[model samples]
Target: MTAPLHHAGFFGFDVFGTVVDWRSGVARAARPFLQRYGIGVDPFAFADQWRALYQPAMEQVRTGARPWVRLDVLQRENLELLLARHGADVATLAEDELADLNRAWERLDPWPDAVAGLTRIRRRFPIGTVSNSHVAGMVQLARFGGLAWDAILGAEMAHDYKPQPQVYLKSADVAGVPPHRFVLVAAHNGDLRAARACGLRTVFVPRPLEHGPGQDTDLEAEDDWDLVAGDFLELADLLGCP
Candidate 1:
């Protein structure tokens, strides 16, 4: 890996699926249920369904049909669907058990390099997450991952989710940096595409395993992204010093 990059006025960073490995965490947490349900399922299927629920839920808020809800709320909502479809009675799930499951995002495992890489990068950038997560979820995830961000920006604060310029802009606003100065680094090409569409500089870090096993990774970065890295540390090097 190369030396870290520095951005004097950069604003927010992202949390899930970026700094940490969210799918692995979820799959690990839900394994017992997956076994108990006796449902013929693969780990990636659950992860994909969980992510698929995100956009539709956000569309409800974006279209103004449903009130703004945090990603955690949406995850729990979708989790209920997962359980029901797999034969678990929602009524039988205790509140504590459900809450623990909902907090799984907060407890995500970081990439092996995440903490060290973020620590090195934070010295030069005012890093933070521009996520659709609730403050509680983001904070807990940051705490768990040992991510040292200067701020945590969420779509919940904006009353909407990403793929919307507002969520991206909100992070810039919260971090007190202009959109151009902030670089969105992510594993999802779709998300990087959104940030690029909004005129923000972007870095693509591919997590081939975001979909779990037997899945193909997002190997290509759009030509327009500022840079693409094998990992966050390499991304840090690619950015270079001020």
Candidate 2:
């Protein structure tokens, strides 16, 4: 049997996909940009392809091949590559226009239950983000989504990305909680597995539509996690929140 969540001192949440709808949000933001460039690709496909570069871009930093730069930098680099691949006339775009398009990540909407569920859970325990996003981006995303976080903790803080032990350990350290007492709530099984290996309890909240309608991965808990909830509302209930 799993231990009660009340015993945990801090909850570290994975922001992208887990708390927000990245695909739909990015696609919405990309639609107009694509049309302006006369690109005929599907916006959602563009979103997916752009996202496909996320891990590899971060991997460069994680492997020490590149210095620790913010996720914003990596994302911008990836965006340039994606734009080139799609035959967009990148040089013709004004700096502000390109930056605004990159800022789409900051403007994502939360999962329908996210804000309310976090509010309920926050009534009982401290909650914050353990995301790959930088501080500035996270601040904007929180403001846009109305996600009231107690703190922002993750890759930016640790100078590394997810599945990296330091990201989880550093977040728990920043929260002033022992690794064993800090619970990580994430949709990705690999993320939870990594956190658990670092001594944090894991809660898997699978987001089936995070990758779009035909998503085949992370649809359900893939291991015997500390807890598995269908969504944040259920997570709040399991946590004994009001």
lDDT of 1 by residue, 1-242 (tens): 12122443673566677778888888776666567556567665776777778778778888889887777778889889877886778887777777887777788899887777777667667678888889888888877878787888869777788878888887777778777777788877888778777767777787776666666767667565677778877766655522
- Estimate, for each residue in 203-231, the C-alpha lDDT of model 2 and write its tens digit: 99989999988999999998999899999
TM-scores for all candidates? Answer: 0.89, 0.98
Error of 2 at 51 (Å): 0.2
lDDT of 2 at 167: 96
- Which residue ranges in model 1 land beyond 4 Å of their true spot? 1-8, 34-44
By TM-score, how accurate is candidate 1? Answer: 0.89
